[model samples]
Target: MGLTQTGTYNTRQLQIVIINSILVVLSITAVSLRVWARRLQGLGLFVEDYLSIFALALSLGVNALLFQSLHAGVGEHVDTLSTATVEAYSLNLYVMQLFWNTCLPVIKLSIVLFYQRIFPVRSMIIACRSVMLFLAAWYIAFQTTAIFQCIPIHHEWQKKTTQGKCIAFVPFVTTLAATNLCTDVLLLILPTRQVWKLQIPWGRKVGLSAIFTLGIIVCAISIVRLENLIAISNSDITWSDTYSHLWTAIESSLGVVVSCLPSLMPIVRLVKSRGSRRDGKSLTGIGQGSSYPSYVRGPYELSEVSNRVSTGPTRTRLRAGSSHSDLIRKQAGDIEIITEIDQTVESTNHSNNI
Candidate 1:
């Protein structure tokens, strides 16, 4: 059914406010926990951390604009709103789009950078950098188009008085939504190949893959948002676009949450390890049979431990001691896989004399 602007109010206004307000609080909490996790591991912030902080800032701006639009009668029928109120809502919506556009790319970049930090293989690094470049270009192109979609910028909201041309709304939005969805899918796939190649046990590899692929939830949100965008009618925009705005807010904030999740793993491990210690349980199941001693290092940092063995040839390999699960858990951003290499080789003569 077509959306008709016959009613005085759409009850969805309250729903939008409630849903988005809760999301804002959650995103803030997720980022805070991420920072705390890093500190618990005694590590300095990296590029991904900074980018997530910046993305959270942008998300807050977007939320502010959304609330402003709601106050400006964005959920009311156009026939019920005063001309000035309509213009106010339109103006808020216009600005919110720009912020939303910028915010999504920033969130994706943060995730890509996180991948770069955790999976330091040469091919993974190259792929991540390529994705980073693509995201930067994506943001520039879409943001530029959104900024100038109307020939005279104010015409976007002041349609009556402004004599100017503007791009077709539905087609432009369709393209934007399609591209966003594509990028989301690309990001979801980027880490899976590298994850499966890890030397960890198959169960551990599956667990890590699950953590990295959490972005699929965000992608599903994007698909729903795109569908809503396609189905919306331009005439009753204030009413029809309510769901669109809701999903956009959701997708953006949820992106932040997903991006921060991996980083928050360290905190989870720390809590679990403490609880296990209190219960007098052993955390040594995964590291059994390894003769090397390994120390905890901050997630994503490489550490090496050298040992001399009298009977064996020199060998080097990735070792996870009693903290194997901790290392696996740190893939979220707190675990480090220690490298252990026997630095000394026993000479045959020395071995025979011994």
Candidate 2:
């Protein structure tokens, strides 16, 4: 059998590959279905969630594809691949190469842009803009480090001795990882303090909190994946060495999922309301349409209540002076509500990726 080579992935690698493929499918489906469900419920096609979902699709796919390539040289063919631990670690570095070069920085940037929706106050706006600048600077520095880490780039996977030509990796990736983790925590945390001030219900506050919790989830991914870096600090290979790849899968996948969760609220509320309508007719019917309809509209108009009347067949007499409230609510609802009806932005990010 000659000297058995370490790089051939064997069944274990295949299994992990399959598992990663499942995550890729789940992440894509969750985001896509969530998007579709929004359209179904009239939540409109939002770019915020869809962009991350699509980016995850690319990042995860590249991770999977590139890892499988490294696995190709495993078995008795020792010379075809580098040392086992090094190959796996480098696979991570390369997967990161794909992500940093193409995806993560972009995802983080778009996420900051989406923040403007929930935060329109001047200072919050400026802070969020600064976050965008931070994201851009990080991306530029990150890709530079990743590119220089492996000489000729092809040597990353091709088994060539990088010899003096490539930049030593520890400083580069660890800095990248630390910076990434820090920013993930910041992006997730910054908006939340501002979100707390919203007059939305406690449950809504909790929901916003849950959405921001994704930042913590991202933090965990960073921390846990750091273990992989430590494992590879000397470029050692083993199933343990690759656990970080699994963490990477999780971290990026969940970021996309959590990013989209807030957008799904309206979809969920819309569905439940429909389900309730199906189960039984309403006594007051005030809560009949999407959400309390009162809550779905903005706080400014619906913030207070007063006498109002409905001239239509229902003859529903609302609080009188609340007409101004209803007018503003109806108008605001008119524009925002239609966002749920339009369904075409879905593929736009795919183009962005291309």
Give the CA lDDT, 0 to 100, for residue 305 in model 1: 24
TM-score of each: 0.79, 0.68
> What is the C-alpha lDDT profile of model 2 across 150-230, one tens digit per residue?
667667654544443666555566667788888888887787876677655688678667766766777887888776766
* TM-score attained by model 1: 0.79
Give the Cα lDDT of each candidate.
0.71, 0.54
Tens-place lDDT digits, model 1, residues 1-354: 111266333478778778889999999999999888666555568888998999999888887777777767666667777777788877888888998999999999888887886677899999999988998898899899999999899999999777989999878887999999999999999989987876667887788789878999998999999998898777888778878878888888889999998887656656665566444332321121124333333122233322222223222332222121222222323333323221222323321110
Off-target runs (Cα >4 Å) in candidate 1 are 1-10, 281-354
RMSD of each: 8.7, 11.6
Candidate of highest TM-score? 1
Query: What shift in Å separates residue 253 of candidate 2 from its native position after superposition?
Result: 1.9
In model 2, the runs with Cα more than 4 Å from the true position are 1-15, 41-50, 66-70, 73-96, 155-164, 233-235, 238-240, 282-354
- What C-alpha lDDT does candidate 1 achieve relative to the native structure? 0.71
Clashing pairs in 1: 262-332, 330-335
